[model samples]
Each structure stands twice: as C-alpha cells, then as structure tokens.
Target chain A: MPAPTAEQEQAIRDAVVRGFDDQVRFLQELVATPSRRTDEADAQRLMARAFEDAGLTVDWLYGRGAGDMKGGLVANLFAYKALRAAGLLPEGRVHLQSVPEEECTGNGTLSVMQHGYTADAVVISEPMGEALVRAHLGVIWFDVDITGTAAHAQEMSRGFNALDAAFALIVRLRELEQHWNEITVGDEHFGDQEHPINLNVGVLEAGEWPSSVFDRCHFSVRVVVPPSLGSQRAWEQIEQCVEEAREQDPVVSRGHATVSRSGFFSDRYVLQPGSEAEGLLRELFSDVAGRELEAFATPAYIDSRVYGNYQDVPSLVFGPVAESLHGKDERVNLESVKRCTEIYALYMARWCGVREG
Target chain B: MPAPTAEQEQAIRDAVVRGFDDQVRFLQELVATPSRRTDEADAQRLMARAFEDAGLTVDWLYGRGAGDMKGGLVANLFAYKALRAAGLLPEGRVHLQSVPEEECTGNGTLSVMQHGYTADAVVISEPMGEALVRAHLGVIWFDVDITGTAAHAQEMSRGFNALDAAFALIVRLRELEQHWNEITVGDEHFGDQEHPINLNVGVLEAGEWPSSVFDRCHFSVRVVVPPSLGSQRAWEQIEQCVEEAREQDPVVSRGHATVSRSGFFSDRYVLQPGSEAEGLLRELFSDVAGRELEAFATPAYIDSRVYGNYQDVPSLVFGPVAESLHGKDERVNLESVKRCTEIYALYMARWCGVREG
Candidate 1:
C-alpha cells in the first residue's frame, strides 16, 4: 500500500492546530475529575458531558449483565456525524456551542442500544494516551495469601510461623519468574517481544506485631501480559503456577494454606498489523501534528478493547498524553491534546462516510 | 527414716487443719486483688502489707539499688530473733511466744528483676482447692520475622511473596522439630516420652493490604525446649536452622532475604526435688487433707528457678487449680483460695524454722 499524500498530511496539521485550545481545555477538565476504573457513574458523566459539548450526540453504554466484571471501568460514548457539521469541530473550535444538559441517563448500556447512530466508524474517547495508537497490552492482577501458625515469642518452637510460610511461597514465586524467563522464547506485536511480562507485588501484610509470630498474610499483585502470549493462556499459566507453588510448602503436610484467586486482571491485546484503520489514523495525526507520527503499542489498556473485541471495530488508543492522569499534579501537554482532538474530528469526517445510513 | 508415732501424726494433722482456717481468709484477700507481674507497684504494696501484718521482720531489696519500691511489699521476711528485735514487727508476732508466725518472702530476682516470676515453690495464696501444689515445666517465648518481595500478582513468578517466604520458614521450623525428634536420641526427657516437645506459633502478619505482595512478615514462635535439651543447645540449633532456611529464598542470592536475628530468650527451669522443705510441706498437707499428697507437673513456668539457682534454695511449685487465669470470667473459688493460704502459711512457718529462723 502507498503512503499518504503531502496534501493529506498538511490538512491534518491545519485541523489539529486550529482545534488546539478547546481540545486541551477538554482534556484538562477530564483529568481534573478522577475516573477510577470502578467509578462507572461519575466517569460516564464526565465523558458524556465532554463529548456532548464537543458537538456529538453522547450515548452511554453500561456493563449490565456483564458476568463478574468487577475490575472493569466502563461506560461508552457514541458521537455522530452532526459533530462535523459544526465545522468548528474539525477546525478545533468545537467547544463554542455546548448546551448544558443536566439529567443523567443512569442506564448507560441500554441508552447506547437505543440512541446510538449507525456510523461506518466509532471512537471510544478514553484517557488512553495517543502514544499507543496501534498496539496496546492487557492488564492482569491477582491476590496471594499465606498462612502459618501463631505462637508466643518465648516458646517459638511450639507454633508454626505464618511469616515464614508466606516468605517461602514468595521466594518460590520469584523463582517461577526466573524459570519463566529461561523458557519464554518469542515476541508479540509490541516489542522485540519475548512478550512484555512485568510483575509487581505492590502491597504486603504479614504478622500484626513486629515481633509477633505471624499466622497469616496477604499480598496484592499486578502484571501486564503481552499479546505474544495469548491472554487466556497467560491467565491459566498463572493459576497453574500458584498451585504448583503449594506443592513446595513444607507446612502443607500438617495444615492448609490459603492463596487467593481474585483482585485485578490484565489481558494482552494485538491489533492486526497494517490494517485499514492504521493508514487512515496515520494520515490524520500526521497532518494535524505537522510531523511524522510514530505509532506504538500502549503500555496499559483502555476502553478501546471493548469496541475492538465485542463489535469488531478497528479501535486504536488515542487521547491527551495521559502520563500523569492518575497521579498527583496530573497534566497533559496542550499541543498534543489539541492535535489529538483535531485528528479525532478529521477521522470522523473522512471515515464515517457522509451517506444517510 | 522411721515412721512418726500415731500421736505425732495426729498432732501434725490438727495443727495443719488450724492453719488451714487462718490461711483461707488470708488467701482470699491476696487472690482477690489483681497482681499481675508487670503491675509491680500494686503487687509490692499488697505484699508488704501482708508480710508486715503477718508479724514478720521485713527488709526491702531492689535490683537497681533499693527503694524505687512503689509498693510497700517486704522484699525479704524472717522470724530470726536478732532481726525481729526492738519491736521490728507488729504485735511482736515475730517473737512467736507459742504459735510461731509464718513469714512470706518476696523474691527480688523474680517478680522484681524479671517481668514475671518463674518459681519452683510459689505460694501465690490464690484460692485453690486443698491448697493444691505441683511442679511446673519451663517455658520459652519467641519472635521471628520473614521478609519477601512484592511484585504484580500476575507476575507472581517475578515477585517475592513475603507471606510465602515466612510460611516456608515456619514449615522448616516445624521440620526442625521432627529432626530434633529423630536426632535427639537418648534424650531421657523426650525419648519415647509422649510430648517430649511442644511448639506453638502464635501470631502472624504481613502486608496491611489484602492483595499486596508481602514485604515483611512476623510471627511469634513458642517452642518449649525440653528442660532436658536445654536453652543453650536449643538456641544454637535454632540459629543454625534459620540460617539454613535462607537457601530457600530467591532474593538471598541477590541480597539478604531479610534473614534477621532476634533473641526471644528462654527461661528454661527444672523443679527442685527431694528437699527437706518440700518433704515437710507435703507431709503437712497430706496429714491435714487425709489423702496421699499429690505431686504433678504443668506446662507453665514459675519463680522457683531463682531460688534453686542463686541461693540454692530448694523449690517446689504449688498453686491453686483453676480453669484459666488469663481468660474470660477468671475467678477462683473462695474455699479453694482459703485452703491455699493455710497451706502456704503452714509450709512457710515450717520451712522458716518458724520460731527459730
């Protein structure tokens, strides 16, 4: 396939520069309002308000009937053709005509089914960064628990030590990682790919007192699995690994130890390479930014997975450079955000096909 | 030694019965007050008042010099003529014109220098049925800490599970017991002796969060090194055992897996047997109660070791029997308490050379 024409690139830059100010303002507003994964209602409100203000009809999608979607942060927004009619949108002055609509459509999923317009293409406006417009990784989280026995410090020999028990499992768990390193031999779309596997044991609790004989403990875990290893495969491997770990526990002969199975999950994602949407978004971002855009895979996941997975939509991650979104002093570069908004507007106009569907 | 004549036996029995009545009132007063070892001031006051009231010459001794003594409890009580002169005691009771006064001596090394008393012969005067007395086994407390790594739960392979690490150590510690059981051949205290060893791991803690990787864990280990095995040998063995446990941790190769050293120092003691004092007390009780004087051993430790070690004072363990002293609804029967007091008084008088001491 041939690359984009010079004219197409210039138009993208013009549109992005024109739409810079309003786009940056919108991003700032979104980040200012916390949007934790589980804060579905509040997040929806923020997204709906912002999209509607940008001259698009906002449709919210709830995750109802979603079996055990505990860790998912959800709500969908569908903005239609009319957004381009404002002309100000493509030029990035989209915020000039926003009507303040106060009522909440509490039923997000149902509202999406009813109010969503039939468009050739869809955009999921999440906080996902523009950095990973092509390929993004999945997130996985789990909980581990270790239990021992309680005993008085003076008579340590009489009781089994839970802290020791927890440490034993943890050591083996680390060994497992090294073991995986020795065996994992390939790549995913994201990198030189021996599948980007990052594991973080973030939180920990063992004995209650500093000098106490701990009988139980709990720890939280987080991981970003790469697409090289299929999502389902990775999950199964982790669970199996935990079971195999139990076999190493010396205390198992006398009593049982608890290892938790829930809390946080990550799945890898691989967008089909050299797809139709890739060229389309590339032309738009390049034109808007007045520079060659380097497309990369996302480090974390976003709502784009919902569209890419469920509706078979060719969704790419793009938003304000969201580096500091969940942290203290969160900020987005004004130039990048404005460029992203203009690209979004141009994609809607070109990709949506101007026919009455 | 020949058996005593019938009149001598009858006289001894009558004297013990009389002593029992007076002792019941005394024991109730002493036991009713909460005299935990840590509550030294109150315990001292209660002791001093009781000793002086009993008409014994008193002298106070403090480990840190003297007279930080919050309570007026007599440190040492004696009925010797020289010590009691010049109206030293109340009512000249120390003179003992006919019926000699019994003096209760407070052990400075115990219930003073130490946190609590681990005695061979402790007359708590706590309400007990028939002034029950028995020998007690030695006790030791322990505190152990285990450290592990924190990583993403999904990447548990890469993370160190502190809980697991601690758990593993605990298991090793348990295994060490079995090793001890096997290797401790010809250990008369344990060889084929049921419950030759007792261990209790009492407390456990790790990360504060449920899903965190356990960074640090602590558990209390209560192992009773048999009086036969000895604390010196036990401590050496335990130190080596924990050191060996480091081999199981992954981080140990990278750095210290936080294999720490702590002293939950053991206060192992053995009962003093076949002493003149014990024989007299046993005889007195058996005569009064009309039953073979019962002797038994307990898992708990007492202050008898101080006397047996430092002063070479022969010691015996005797206290009121109760369901639980530290648990809920803790109370002793009034009658039992009274019996304990009388027994203590009779024994004290007899052992102190009553009028001669």
Candidate 2:
C-alpha cells in the first residue's frame, strides 16, 4: 500500500487540528458519563449520533462492550469526519458497531457478528499508548474454598485451621508463579519480555472470631495465561498445584478444599507477525508518530481477542495512553487521542482504498 | 488443719440442704444479670446485699471483676449464710470482697489488697467442674504490624506483599509453638498433660483491595505460658522468633515489621502441690464428692493468678461445672452449687475454726 502523499498528509493534519476541540469535547463527555460495565446506554447514543454525523452506518450493540469500546468508537467517528472534510473518504464500507457486556462476556460482540456485521480488518481502541497491540495474555479468575473443623483455641489439636490451609495454598501459588516465570514461550514477537504469565491473589477472607479455630476460608485469584500456555493448560497446572498442596496436608487432602473456575475465563489471542491487518496498523502508527512502533504483549485481556479469535476478523488494539485506568482519577491524554485519530484516518484510506471525487 | 467433726459435717450437710433453694435462686439471678466486663454494677449490688445478709463485712470493688466474680461472690454469700444458720461461723474474720477489672488487669484486686484486705488463704470460685485448679498457664496477647511497599498487582515485584510477610510470621509462630510444646515444665502437678504451651493466631487482617498489593497487615495472637516459663521468658521467645523471621526475609529484616505486646499479659500462677490451701481444698472436694479431685493446670487466665502470685495469697480455683462460661448459653449446675456450698462451710469450720455463739 502506498503512503499518503505529502499534500494528503497535510490535509489530514489540518483537518485533525480543526476538529481537535470537538474530539476532546466528545471524549470528555463520553468519559464523564461513567459507563462502567453494562451501564453504557447514554454513551452508546452519543457515539451512534457521532457515527451518523460522520456518514457511516451505525449499529448500537447495547452491552458492556459499548463502554469498553466507547473510546475507540468516538475516535473512529471523529477520524471519519476529519477524513471527509479533507476529501479522503474510503471507498469501502465503514460499519461502526457499539456492543455490550464485553467486560464480563463477549455476548454483545457475538450478537453483532451474528447480525451479519463483517469487516476485512478491525481496530479496537483499548488504551495501549502509541504501540499497536497484536496479542494479549488470556485471563482466568477463580475462587478456592477451604473447610476445616472448628474447635476452641484451647483444644488446638482437635481443630483444623482453615487459614493454615489458605497459607498453604498461597505458598503453592507463589511456587506456581515462579515456575511460570521460568518458562520461555519462544515467541519472537514478545521480545525480551521474560515472563508474560502472572498470578494475582486478589481477595482473601477467613475465620469470624479470633478465639475459635477458623472453619472456612475463601480466596480469589486472577491468572494470566501466555499464548503458548492457553487457559486449559494453565488451569491444569493450577489443579496440579492444588493436588500437590492437598497431599502435604491431612486436612486439605481429606476432601476439605475445592478449586473452581466460577468467575471468568478467556483464551489468549495472538496475531501472527506480518499479518496484513497487524502490518498495516504498525505502519500507520509509525507514519503518524514519526517513530518506529514497537510491538509487545500485555497481561491485560481486551475485546480484540473476542473479535479476532472468536469472530474470525483480524483485529488489533491501538489507543491513547490513559494513566490509572479503572482506578482513581483515570484520565486519557487528549493529544494522543488526536494523534490516534489521524492514524485511524490514514489506515482507513490505505486499507479500504480512497474514493476519488 | 483437722478435718471437720462428723457432727459438724452433719450440720454443714444439713445447712446446705436447707439453703439449697436460696443458693439456686442466687446463682440463677447472678447469671441472669449479664454483667459483662465493666457493666457489673447491678450484679455487684446484689452480691453486696447478699454478703451483708450473711452477716459478713462486704467491700464492693467495682469493675469487670464483679462480673467474673459474681458466681463466686454468690456462692460465698450463701455458704456463709448456711454456716451461720447452722452455728458454724469461723472464728477468724470472713471478709467478702467484690473486686473489678479481673478480666482485663488486676487493678481492682491490687487496690483491695493495698487497702488491707489480708487473708491466711484465698479461695477463688472459678468454674472448673469437680477438679481443683492449683496451677494455671499465664497468657500474653500481642500484635505484629507488618509494613510493605504498595504497588499495583500488574507490577507485583515492585512491592512487598504484607500478607506474605504475615504468612512468614505465622510460620515462625507455628515453629515456636512446636518448640515450646517439647519442653516439659517437669511439674508433677500438671501430670502427663502434653503441650501446656499453646499459641493462638486469633485475629488477622491485611490489604483493603483485592487488585492492589497489600502494603499493611496486622495480626494478634494469644500465647499460653506454663508456670515454669512465665510471661517474661515466653515473651522473649516470641521476640526471638520475630527476629529470626526478620533475619530470614530482607523485607522483614529492614524493620518493615514490628512485634509488640499492646493488649494483655499475665504471669502464670502455681500453688505447691502440698500447700495448706491446695491440700485442704483437695480433701474437701474428695470428702464432699466421694471421689479424688484431680489437680490439673489450665491454659486460660483467671483472677486467681493475681491473688496467688501478686498479692502473696495462697489462692486456688474451685467451683461448679458450667458449660460455655464465656460464650452463649453459659450455665452452671445448681446441684454442684449446693455441693460446693457444703464444702465451703466444712472448710471454714476446719481451717478457720467455727466460732461459738
């Protein structure tokens, strides 16, 4: 694909500068709406209107996906509007989709794909700074429950402490973390990243009273799965760890503890290096930023995995840098948002073929 | 001391049978008052009135001790009344003292002792079924504060997990428990009771958020010290254990964690097996119950430790069997209360010498 001409690039830059204020206002308004999880109805309506104003067919796929995809959705809308103003409309179709429930499940994207929305190449704007995201580690969240016999603290020998079992499990988890860190997936794309697999024990709770022996304990953990070790293999490894722990303790081995994937599970998604969509995204990022865009895998799970792997569309993640995302005072950098808009416009023109008027 | 004459024993038995109804009513009323800790004013008033009714000089030392001593207070009252009614008042002065704060500290008992409440021997009525408590383990409650750097779970290596530090401390505590249990106090008084030393991890808490690395963890533990080890030696052992743990972990060794006795501490109390108070109580229990009373040490801390060790009084715990003393549905056997009254009356006649009216 040919790079945009100097005059065309100048036109695109001029249009982005002209529409920069509107893009900022749109983003701020969308973020201010506070669309967490499935609460994205207002944000969806705003994006749908913006898509229509940019002359693209819009589909409202009401769910959590709409919230996660909002940043990407708004950036796409403004990029299209800026391209049209510069007489750089792509000849191919641009179907803007706003889906739901993508944070917990991929039902929204699935429904949109089932409803016949198809694209040769897809770009998901999940906040990943300037580098294009071609792959992400899979995630599995689970809870382990350990049960023990309760007795008076004075009769220590008569009771089993569930917190002791929890400690045993935590030790096993630490060992598992070390083992996974030692594994090399042999993926050249990951490049110098020693360990992509991580295990986070997020929440733990046990024993109601200090004087009585704890009878029950429940803990939840999130495990990051590398592309080489998919969710199934990772889960099997966790089971083996639990099995080993059970063998070391009489209370745990007496069938007093259980491990279950009751929370969330998703497969790791990786796009082959030099894939058409991935190559196009990398080139566009480089062209827009005037620097080489390094590719790397993230431990975080994103919607691109759903679209690319499940929906069978070649998808990549490219977005602005947002510090402390999903935490206090989360804010996206406005300048990066504008730069991302220009890159999206150039990619559409090159991949979809520009229309000559 | 000579045993009570058969005629005097007959009179004591008859008096106990005659006062059985009043003793039952007094115990039930005392238990019904629900004087937990500092809330013992009502129970104190009732016991003071009962002591005066029994023709004994009563001192109301108000506080938590009033609640703990209410049962003993009521039993003492009715026993004195029964003895007087049967012409069995001891020649020596019988001063009934109701002190407070015995559950927390010995301030009330100390105050009473300072105020010239001296006795040849002290008999404290703590519920121990048919056995007489001549010795008991001391207790120390302390908190360990572990501080660690807080970082996002995504960058776990940058922060020390306080929960992990807590686990390391617990492991050390378990080792200490095993070490203490192996050392025999070599007291025939305890008699084949294995593991007089016990460590209880009562309360544990750490990290507020499941997704963030825990930066702080605080846990409290209770340790039982035999009469041989005492509170000072037990505490020193705990400090040494913490120091060992700190040496093993760099995070802990950097003074990121501290162990301090912030709550409660009490020295163990043990009366010589052949002391007048212990021997007399054992004979009285055997004479009344027609069975040899067992002498054993308990892990729980009680006010007898203060009186026997601190006040220079020969004190022993003897009382009725009560299920769930400090828990819900705490109850005492009315028949045992009657039997205990008979024994107390007989002891007054034999040890203190019955006063001639």
Which is the leading candidate under lDDT? 2
DockQ of structure 2: 0.16
Model 1 alpha-carbon drift over 4 Å, by segment: A1-357, B1-111, B114-121, B124-150, B154-159, B163-184, B188-201, B208-215, B218-220, B223-251, B259-263, B284-307, B310-315, B320-357
The weakest ten consecutive residues by lDDT in model 1 chain A span A65-74
DockQ of each: 0.14, 0.16
True contacts kept of 1: 0.27
| Candidate 2 lDDT tens digits, A152-234 | 45566566777777776777887887777666456654435765666766666666444556667787776776566778998
lDDT of 1 by residue, B33-96 (tens): 5453344455446555656565421121112101111110111222121123312222113211
Clashing pairs in 2: A63-A100, A63-A101, A64-A100, A64-A101, A65-A100, A65-A101, A65-A102, B64-B101, B65-B100, B65-B101
Listed per prediction, chain B TM-scores read 0.63, 0.80
lDDT of 2 at A340: 81
Positional deviation of A271 in candidate 2, in angstroms?
Answer: 2.8
Off by over 4 Å in 2: A1-129, A173-184, A187-193, A226-233, A240-244, A272-280, A320-357, B1-129, B151-154, B175-193, B208-212, B226-244, B272-280, B319-357
**Candidate 2 at A82: error in angstroms?**
9.0
